[model samples]
Target chain A: VEFGGLRAHCPEAALHAARAAYLAGCQATSNVEAGSRFGIPVSGTMAHSWVMAHMDELTAFARYTAVHGARSILLIDTYDTVAAARLIVSAGLRPAAVRVDSGDLAGLSAAVRAVLDAGSLQETKILVSGDLDEHRVAALVASGAPIDGFGVGTAVTTSADAPSLSGVYKLVAVERESGMVPLAKLSPGKRTVPGEKQVWRVARSGETQRDVVATADELGPPGGVPLLRRLMRRGVPTESAPALDAIRDRCRTAVAALPDGVRRLTDAERFPVELSPDLDRLSRRVGGRDDQGP
Target chain B: VEFGGLRAHCPEAALHAARAAYLAGCQATSNVEAGSRFGIPVSGTMAHSWVMAHMDELTAFARYTAVHGARSILLIDTYDTVAAARLIVSAGLRPAAVRVDSGDLAGLSAAVRAVLDAGSLQETKILVSGDLDEHRVAALVASGAPIDGFGVGTAVTTSADAPSLSGVYKLVAVERESGMVPLAKLSPGKRTVPGEKQVWRVARSGETQRDVVATADELGPPGGVPLLRRLMRRGVPTESAPALDAIRDRCRTAVAALPDGVRRLTDAERFPVELSPDLDRLSRRVGGRDDQGP
Candidate 1:
């Protein structure tokens, strides 16, 4: 429903992020473009604007439900959440869900759940969304809020908490007349590791133990699987990309293989990323003794 | 040069924002699509990745300058800032400018300027960019940093400080059987004024004094100039949009007419947005006593 919230900012980025999220195990997206482009399932309710567009909230609900029918997930918090809940039942319109976009979501979800149960509308789910991130989602789950699912925006689209990832395409190695010469930025607090690299994931009994970033030429680490594969060659794709469902399934399996501590929503333990001996040696040679010096 | 720094995240949003900035007084944008779409001047240099791809920083600089000639703006902070400066002058490639992408911008710019002047490359401009915002630019100017212009990203494209603006497309009035009926959301902390509205600005001697948001039906306030004009009737545009240059000029004039306090880069005073008498009356009537009630 709220894909427009982020889409209004950047249609391209929002579509990309939605596709990524969908391919990373998200059940559905509200972005129609994401659905049309990637064949992902699209889901949404109505916006507060829809309710605000009507003379009265009840009329808005009736008109929307009349048109959208059982597919309607009426937005309830535009004026009064509880009042809207009572009104939805009183009008005898059965919507798929009632969404709470603002206010205390956890408490309100519980309260709304009670209202629906009291009205014997047990099948009607409650959906909540407001500045939702992983932490908030975990908190709501921990509190046992009766929210069936989430409608996340802003945070996911913007990558809010850590909006920009620190990625540097540094001079790892340069093609020289004599041979490949290692290169690195020795800038203080911003030194680069030298060489074309590959990540080696070490798993023990189906659980990831650690990852080693190594020079691509190095012999494969014992009991390690290479994570990076050649995706393209000379500006052409090496092979067709996997189906979105297959990728999502692979992601689910990989995530399930993580240790519980590393999977926690908040204060999760960091996974160890070690450098291979060859890469470390090259980095030291290129970076010199004082790594901080420019 | 650094368009990718911002473009990598939100291509759609960045392009839209770039076009908007171009139309609103910005001279040029680094986005190619923005330029192609809006016929705005496109500007850019090379990223660190381009330099890092070469055998050596100096060789990279020489090769780029050899091809691009005087139009090239050599990015100097990829490896060593000062060393790159000396190499640029020593290699006898007088680039149009030298850009600093990282490190202490204010101090580095001054130091780079000294190097350029000492090398007798006085005409070669100094461009600096790294996490720069309006406040940072103002501070750089205040500190007498010899910078030519800026390469602002992230902040402008993402509206980083306040990413999302709360805009509501509410039904001010609903068409009814008899006539149009005013409507408002009485939701706590989100109360809205009813009826179609128009903003009237009261200016004296070219500086804006105040703005009154009035019911559309209300007669124009004395000495007030209407700011909002009908741009479209039904779906079709009322008229072709004004030329980008004209809009840019108008934006510049409008910005210049702002009060100095409101124009400050930091700790700026808030501009008052007042409601018209009729609108205020309607709000009170719609709100009732204890407007916080559900």
Candidate 2:
């Protein structure tokens, strides 16, 4: 939800990041424009700079609580984590959460959780952040870190580990006077399939079994559901454009249906994308790779 | 000047990127917003997608020439680099430049240059792109590739290799009723120097010798030029905010003054950022490393 790092990039990038994160199921974003535009909740823990700006860590927490009340999530790792947690309890401030942004997150979260529980302030949550990604989140969860939530930043915003997706937008067909003509790039090591295309997915017992990339004109193989739909006509969006929530729900269902290998945090198996017979034939003909071309 | 990838990020991001690049000595930007905002020239080569969208590559080139005339930079590596170069010369379409977006940039550019020369179209420039960074650009230059210009994307926009800078904003001192009070963070593996600071550069002739970060209030050591100036006061920018062109010129001068190691494409020696004696003493005292703490 924190987009301060991205703000230095540009206002729109930060806003777009917030929108994408909201659409992808993040609970809230710290960017005000995103909150206003998307109707998502806005929340943020205080920064280390804020804590350092005050005379002491306790003073910063107390001042922030006074201003933001229980809604404030006090950042506890500017100087020390345990001392700050103790100070929060001693000051009788029952904030919504205590965030640990540095140090060993697993140990810190556990220690903070135990202190909050012992003080009968079990309602206060423990939120961990700092270089967290899906793999790190899973590791913390597996270790029973007593974390209530996470404040993901860099890793989420930039897709840091795998920063760029291997996505390509090749023109499948060209509009001609007669009809739509298939196009293909036959460069070695960079060949592209020709013709308008659609992907059909096969699911068995709620799990996706396979997918076929085929020509868009066909109804596709039996027992498979087409994954692409016409969403735009000219410059106008069609009725097929679903509401954000519906799209998010559908995305959740689709992701859940994927096999375990594709869902793993690391070394995920590549999902099969088989080309249909029609698509293969069109590709070969337009690419000048047929028997007659030689 | 190419900014298609950034335009896909966000309009503001694209604009800001263009502004930054222009201010960093780039001659022009492909972003129209930047051109309008900063009075910088805008230029671009056609995308492969545009060519693929048409019935054929030649048709696309002809249509683009009819619209853009000699200003057009025809992209030639969509299907085959050599074949497209031959077509360009044969078709009598004299574009300003021919760009290679894929393949061995060095070899392809040389081949394209030779073909253009043989056809007496020697005025055409050779532009190269695709996963290009400083090192790759340097390699092309070192190998004497016929490249006249480059269209750097991902690496520059994302700051990919060193994606994130280890930037921190520690409140060195807080404003109090009587005076400014210095503060410090004493966390293990992370320490902050106490007090307001300024960096002084000691340059000899046209080359930089060293830099010293010291407390702001003091007159820096002899012959050292203070690099930090008062830019703003109480949320209002001071007169110190110069025009972008002036800032750009200053940046160029400063960069030129840097040592050779700092300018090298790889394995550059880290620039020294030493603290002054008083600043060092203050850091030690406030960080509690002067004596062991329990």
Candidate 3:
């Protein structure tokens, strides 16, 4: 994952984006701070500027490999992709990967792969990048391209198509002169449920089946696990936060437990998230729509 | 300017986005860090959560205005735009401005304006904000919406349409045994000019007419002002940086001096930017195509 696009927003965004990508099962990130802070492996190829700085493509490749050795992921699209791969093989420079950052990635990766394989450099992987999103990546994979890795930047970091989330913090309850009173808004297109809530996840054979949003005071349903824990109280943390790696592992496992229909990228089936009987009753009463059935 | 959207990236980006919006002639920012760091005025109405926290919309308005007084900018769209305005006027709450954040802004602004005027709260201004960009702002202005100010966020902060800038730092010249040698990249679709360069802006009648990109050593053309200044030499300071307010003033003045065609929002005429004769000659020579005419 290349989080450089996130840097356009702020330095902290870069770190957060790197962590998010890691938690989403991304194997590596091109952010150094993420590597040092979260232990996510840092990997990236050279920039086009590096190649332009040298006298020729071969010299740039040779110099970079000399310092980084086989770990160097040569950026070959600075001049020509296939030609650079041939030059690397002809000069016996073994790079961990060759990255193509421009042009038709699916077609270019195949051509570059053929050149590398012909030179007995089958171990050198092919990495493709440039305006890659989930749709493009899926299409590339479906096309049977020889891409070993993908370096996604802007689309993932900026979430360009839908740049903002609509999450809001609502006051579910307020302290009155008498006691704590549950609250709810009847605003048009801006309604809210009353009182504090909890989400209980029901799993079957290690796969998540559904989730129930219920009043905080309610007990978990049979065979269901409470997902919310008191992490903070009275302006202080209630417990030590989990390690970054542990959190990442949990995220991976959670995603894996999602049903196939819900996990699909396109036309995804909505995961069941029903309101519990207690919460539903509270919502109707607070909204002043007691006649409506649950 | 509502730079809250920029916070999605990083804290630093929030500061920079606030600065950029301020330099672009935005009067105020919603970001407090920007207010302290850049001395930009901070202004914001209230969140929906604030309204929902109270027992009723009127109570929310009364409580907010009690603290903020006439300076309060009440958010009216939490329930109903016109109804909220009517409520504010009937309750004798004189807010400085009323903000609308949803629906047809053009239609709602006029309706809210009518309500405020009917109640003899003529001094109360109408502010509108949701997903405003330059185009939407211009259209609103053209449609004669009585909008006093705009709270722009995602569009200005993220530059949603074109998010990432394609800027790359290339090695222009190398110090060699003999002397400095200019370098150029012949990469397809990624060519670069040789040597260090400077931009000379030519203005007439206080309006910028054109700019010339020339070799650093070349003399400025007649009536041309050099735009690049050396702030440091060998990593040491050569001069003090200008204060943020002073820089903001300079930016405002510079933008005002642009020709109307170049400043127009839609299908704007491209500002003339040509390479100087000396630089053009050098580019052809460095590209190894010396036979090509300048």
DockQ of each: 0.30, 0.34, 0.30
Please give the distance, in angstroms, between residue B156's alpha carbon in candidate 3 and its true position after superposition: 3.1
Residue A3, candidate 3: C-alpha displacement in angstroms: 6.1
TM-score of chain B of each: 0.92, 0.92, 0.94
Q: Tens digits of per-residue lDDT for model 3 on A1-294? A: 664533345566777788888888788889888789878889887877688666578888899988999799999987567888899899998899999988888889999999999999999999988768899999999999999999998666666665555465677887766667777756556678888889999999988999999999998788889998888899999889888789988998999999999999899999999999999989988788442212
- Extract clashing residue pairs from model 2: none
Give the range where candidate 2 chain A is weakest over 10 consecutive residues by summed lDDT.
Answer: A1-10
Q: Please give the lDDT score at residue A276 for candidate 3.
A: 93
Indicate which candidate wins on DockQ: 2
Cα displacement (angstroms), candidate 2, residue B31, comes to 2.4
Who wins the TM-score comparison?
Answer: 2
Clashes of each: 0, 0, 1
Q: Which ten residues in a row have the lowest lDDT in candidate 1 chain B?
A: B1-10
Model 1 C-alpha lDDT per residue in residues B241-275, reported as the tens digit of each score? 88878887888888888899998877899987899
Give each model's whole-structure lDDT.
Answer: 0.78, 0.79, 0.82
